[model samples]
Target: MRFLLVEDNAELGDAVVAWLSMEGHAVDHALTLAEAHDWLAVAEYDLMLLDVMLPDGDGRSFLRETRTAERLPVIVLTARSQVADRVDTLDLGADDYLTKPFDFAELEARCRAVLRRRGTPAPVVIPLGSALFDPSSGTLTQDGESQRLRNRELRLLEVFARNKGQILSKSHLLDRLFSQDAEVTENAIEVYVGRLRRRLQQAGVQIETVRGVGYRMTAP
Candidate 1:
């Protein structure tokens, strides 16, 4: 997932960005409303984490102005806990609101829920023979049992499952598995693919090497 975090507080901004990155998300952060707008103009984001207060402008005004202009999902971060404030923000098109001093875990959960609502209509539970893959939770189950996987391996598996039977090159896998700024080598992909192939054997899934090409996934 790609996210835009618009927060003036450096500490909070850094914390959120780090947490999201650890969860396999690409985050672009801005400290002001103008900077946030610039990001929105150039690149599309899966989600936006906007603050109610900005040095240059009110975040609510920004939300109101661009709500109809784009289909981006937004979750408002504000200290305002009053019913009127919440109602007004919601009316102005905020998808979810989090007050100050909120739990980081709760924030993560809300962000995920908002994304689930805005994300593609594709099914979360993908079946591979007797295996069940939930991209949302990053879990795989085989024959009613859960299997452990490294985060990168799980993400790589999801890419293959989404594009099952299509040859996926090392470069394409690297792009999908890591953020634009992530330092990862093409050789790293080979390791993950190999690990996944061995682990997936019992699930009746196969990751076939395409000679000089790449890899493909099959469930039979």
Candidate 2:
């Protein structure tokens, strides 16, 4: 999953980004509404973590305007713990609200809940031939055995499994796989794809390279 985290606090923003990224989700952190707008203009994000008090403007107003423009799922992260504030934000179309100084684990749960409610929720476990791939934990199970995959490999597997049989361009895969790393090259993706292909081959899955265009995944 890809997330656009809109917050201004350096400490909090850094912590959230690190936490989400470690969980195998691609995250782009925007420190202000202007930066958020720029990110929104360029990339399609699965969720937005918006801070109510930004350096540039009120996040509530931004949420209102954003609702009019797109169907992006937003979870407001704010210090305002008032019941009225929560109700008002919900009325404005926020999918969820998290007050400041909250638990990171809780935030992660809320994010998953909001995504499941707002978007096409992925299966809890996707069957790939003889294996079962769990998106939530990035684990692949086969023959009643399961093992958690490395972060990048898990992300690549999830992306491929979600869009099975569709040809994904290198540029598109690059954006999804290496959103936070500007230094990663297309060659890096090839390495990851090669590794994932080897793993999936045992499960009766194939990752096909489309010559000059991109790659496609098919499961038997």
The most accurate candidate by lDDT is 2
lDDT of all predictions, in order shown?
Answer: 0.84, 0.89
Give the per-residue lDDT digits (tens) of candidate 1, residues 72-167: 889999999999999999999999999997787898889878877876544389988778888767778887788766677777887888889899
Clashing pairs in 2: none
Instruction: Count steric clashes of candidate 1.
Output: 0
Off by over 4 Å in 2: none
Model 2 per-residue lDDT tens digits across residues 100-198: 998999998999899889865755789888899998787898888888888888988888888899999888887886665467888988999999877
- Candidate 1: segments with Cα more than 4 A from true spot: 119-124, 143-145, 166-177, 185-191, 202-204, 207-216
* Per-candidate alpha-carbon RMSD to the true structure: 3.2, 1.4
